[model samples]
Target: MTDLATPGSAGLLNGKRLLITGVLSDMSIAFQVARIAQEQGAEIVLTSFGRALPITEEMTRLLPAPAPVIRLDVTRPEDLERLPLEVTRHLGALDGIMHSIAYAPPGALGGRFLDTPWQDAATALHVSAFSLQALTASCADVLEDGASVVGLDFDASLAWPGYDWMGVSKAALEAVARYLALYLAERHIRVNLVAAGMIRTVAARAIPNTDHLETIWRNRPPLSWDVSDPTPPARACILLLSDWLSATTGEILHVDGGLHAVMT
Candidate 1:
């Protein structure tokens, strides 16, 4: 409840209700999305799980308006089952969902692709890739028609030095999004992803050779890429979450400062 300035007039998501997940800190892209969503007049509920719940609750205090933090571990079926009830209690039906959750066990990341065990890889796939479907399905009862589902992504088109299984998971995530978009189309619910460039978030830092990944951005993108700013990608998420992209689904919006388009 740190009362920041509200937007002067109706903003992009004015009067919309949103469910934003994976907001662990101020540096989190999800955190920036929540802040901007509030400025744009969207009512948002954030989700964290287990040990991260308290941290996310603290982060909510930094938003323009007070947002309730709900416990949701996408890997846990019990938590998924309670999601609709929890969302209904807070914001009734949802207009949009920001699925920013992603994780891979240490064994599955950092150049261990060949050495990574099946259990570790499976964990990565479940939490990082499959959670998108699980999350959307869990909230199906609460999501309104024409609702948007936007997930955060890194460019999964190529193999990087240390991304390893997480990269595989991201590739799987893209497929999941496309399938979700196709299925949810019947309900007019748009599902898309924003493939962002590397930013220095806690999760990004955990990956070995992140500097090499950042170096690629610095050298290749026609438009300059800022590793410190989450604003560009966050804004992309906002646009996808808004009705402006009502006709767009099963798409991947690149917010990587033109890097994804470069030949190098």
Candidate 2:
């Protein structure tokens, strides 16, 4: 029998230097990723700002490796522009980037899809989709050749209830991942998105009618899904960031407990 804790299996992310964003609380997927990455021997830098910074600082103490926090508000141009320099000073170089940042105004979600204004929709697209481009570009110089970029995503093909314009933003995020993969191919940088099941984080719980979505999701997947269990998606992100997925790019790997495949 194989020992699951052997270095080969356990240190899949050994020596990888990554920048992880979007960690708001311990319940977040990004928080789990940061913790697991450190456990697997990876070095990480976390990003946060404003009121969220204090919370993320408290979270850093929970990781095995001490991750330094950086102030990177994706919407702020100064923050984006200075990222490369800051990361260089902090981590020297980046082997991977986990784009966990995404936001949509309340008006853009919670069943306001048809009624959402252009401004709200624009905010969603810009923050949730375009920011990927901005973040990657800002870190391009520091990204080592063969760097892997993974973004958190939800199924954008289906019109999800209560998600509204955020659904459209996720779709745009998918397209952006594809284009980034194509453009970065020359540099040997790979980009992919892990389409995850609805996890009960602060963001998900904020959505209106989420209880209804969660009820259907629990019974729908052939392989059982727990709204609280983030292991599957977090593991998928680690796989993408490691050398194990050297040739996989522009892909959407579903960590949704087979719900997407079985749903009619």
Candidate 3:
């Protein structure tokens, strides 16, 4: 939607302030999104917790202009309550927020879908889904009335090899996005998701039977795709965050090489 002719061009997100979470490694999609967002002129503030903070700080150096890292443990009420202050300390106000955080205990994933205890499943939902609501509320005062909120999503309409409880959590996340969109509508804020295809990130490796999962994707995608390439989804995110998609909200933009369209 940006006037820039070439994709990934500069100035698309000019002068915007963005808060990005779940940037734990260089290979993470949030990391690429942050780098591209900064290249497009958005001032980025990345969030990390205890041990991950120093590593995330190290990752920031790789950015075009190193962004400051902030402490935000999504499950912590105190952390969520104080996010606005920390964000304002570095960047005055937020134009967009990208929620890329998700986690499931080992018992909740793998082939233990039914065996996972309620506590684990609940933890999955709280961190992977409910945190979106918590985050939006915590940052509400700073988020502009017309600001955009985007989250990373996996297609949860169907089950996957080892995604297990995380798959259920993603389904909850989809619903969470819809609800957030409705709730934020009156405020002129936009809430949407990018339901991404498989990418070989740290989180992906934890899932069991990834090789089979990759096979299904490789054979299914209408457009050629690389499991290692995150640019497509990252680009979609920046587009949503930019003024280009001001009219769009409560939508799921699938960046999976058109795989979801195929019935087989």
Over 1-264, each residue of candidate 2 has an lDDT whose tens digit, in order, gives 221232224587888899999888777889888888877778899999999999999888877657899999898999999999889998999999999978898999988788899999999999999999999999999999999999999999899888889899999999999999999999999999999998988888878888988887788899889998777798899889989989999999999989889854
lDDT of 1: 0.91
- Each candidate: what lDDT? 0.91, 0.89, 0.89
Ranking by TM-score: 1, 2, 3
Lowest lDDT 10-residue stretch of candidate 3: 1-10
Best by TM-score: 1
Winner on lDDT between 1 and 3 is 1
RMSD of each: 2.5, 2.2, 2.5
Model 1: CA > 4 A from native: 1-8
**Steric clash pairs (candidate 2):** none
TM-scores for the candidates: 0.96, 0.95, 0.95
Tens-digit lDDT track of model 1 for 1-264: 332337434888888999999898888999999999999889999999888899999998998889998899999999999999999999999999999988888898888889999999999999998999999999998999999999999989988878899999999999999999999999999999999998888889888898898888788899988888888899899999999988999999999989878676
